[model samples]
Target: MTATYQELRRSDLPSLRREIRAGHYAKHTAGLGPGFLQTNLAIMPEAFALDFMRFCQRNPKPCPLVGVSDTGNPMMVTLGADIDIRTDVPAYNIYENGKLTGSREDITDIWTDDLVAFALGCSFTFERALEEAGIPQWHIDHDTTVPMFRSNIETVPAGPFSGKTVVSLRFIAPERLDEVIAISRRFPLAHGAPLHWGDPEKIGITDLGAPEWGDPCEIEEDKIPVFWACGVTPQVAIERAGIPLCITHKPGHMLITDIAEDAEVPVRNPRAA
Candidate 1:
């Protein structure tokens, strides 16, 4: 008999995360888990959960919260049936005094009783939706990580969680911009709409080739640079939040789950084409 998990082309996400957790794979999770939801992970102490939740609520554009684990628990039962918060993500960064000190594949050895995990919806999930909608993603096409940058735009504060919004940049042709906008808005759980287009410097980006995170993509003359609120925004916030200790999924390595992608609902944007 064929394994049920193996039968899924890109849909067998839980097993994928499990393999990633066990050190079977460590690479960018861009095109994997076609129909399932993938998220950014941020683990901090329960002491700051309320403020962080409010930070997400107040600044939904950059910090759309998708799932939260109970204090001291490594299980993210709500996000996936057997999700283990500490080991499910492909890679993790440990921070101390707001500085990244180390990286890990799993955090079970260091997991503490007071830690809480937050899973924020990521654009990878919606990008899969966009592909299904017949929109092309240039970064994927060029085999490069999506470009990201820190913006001049400030996020609403909740306690210590505050900073300028960081965004992932994509270049799309003029003919497809309208359709991209329409498809993205349907996934509000993820960063719903783009923040800016055309000029990167208008958002404090000095150079398109030099990115704060991820690999840079080459832009063609016919394509324009477009920016969207990214899940990495929380990493910037966690830095500003000044938490003595925190952990987050390394950029591009996400936590994939069992959500359907083709089930996207049509969303009409009044101001968008």
Candidate 2:
């Protein structure tokens, strides 16, 4: 007889982070961490932290600031106890002079004292509610990254930070569109509702099959495409700024936090490292 084990489809917050930090799970974090807040990560030197903070403030829809790690401190006390910014995210992309230079799984070797890390709210927070309401999420069902696009809709400029917005797409059934919108709107921290739906062209998205990030979605005939402001918007701003060194979570690979969307205190798992 052989032991049987099925792949993980649901997990508690601490176990997920422990898995990610240990360099075991590195896939897109779309369907994982259900009901907990998943965040987009941006790490840069102290020199650019202020401008980037203002940038996130001005562009709240796409770049809602949730927590900022103290300068030179690797422990993200505000978001979760013992969460290591350098290794907790599933994947990381490194940028130099506004260009993607490389990617790494654990940035421990490159971590430095001058770096400051910021966690921005991600739309995945509202997904549990959508699931509870019986709204279908195509990407989750397909086990693919949500299709993301860079739009012509300009962001409000803050200091050296400014760029067009990025949005993630989901095709909703005509009957579920209103409920999905209402539920999503309630989570102000999670990009807060759809920015544009129906016409990708209106937002300068020319092709539905081709996306700037994540996997391309196969749109069903009865489903309507709904666009939501995305946390990935900061990556574009970081690119344009061209700071000497910057790091961000790979699109769709988020920093799973111990904080539940509604919980005031961090959730802990005694076994998690």
- What's the count of clashing pairs in each model shown? 0, 1
Tens-digit per-residue lDDT, 1-273, candidate 1:
222323333545555665677777766677787766678888998888899889988988787777888899898876666778888787899988788899988889999999999888788878877778777887777656788899999999999999999999888889989888888887877688798999888999999888989997786768888899998988898888789899999998888765453233222122211
Best by lDDT: 2
- What TM-score fits each model? 0.90, 0.93
The root-mean-square deviation over C-alpha atoms between each candidate and the true structure, in angstroms, is: 5.8, 3.2
Task: List pairs with backbone clashes in candidate 1.
Answer: none
Compared with the true structure, what per-residue lDDT tens digits does model 2 show for residues 1-273? 211111334556666677778787777887677766788999999999999999998899999888898999988887777799999998999998889999888999999999999998898889878888888888888788999999999999887788999999988998888988998988887888899989789999999899899999896777888999998899999888888999999999898776676443334323333
Whole-model Cα lDDT per candidate?
0.79, 0.84
Which pairs in model 2 have colliding backbones?
98-242
Error of 2 at 3 (Å): 16
Task: Rate residue 164 of model 1 by lDDT.
Answer: 91
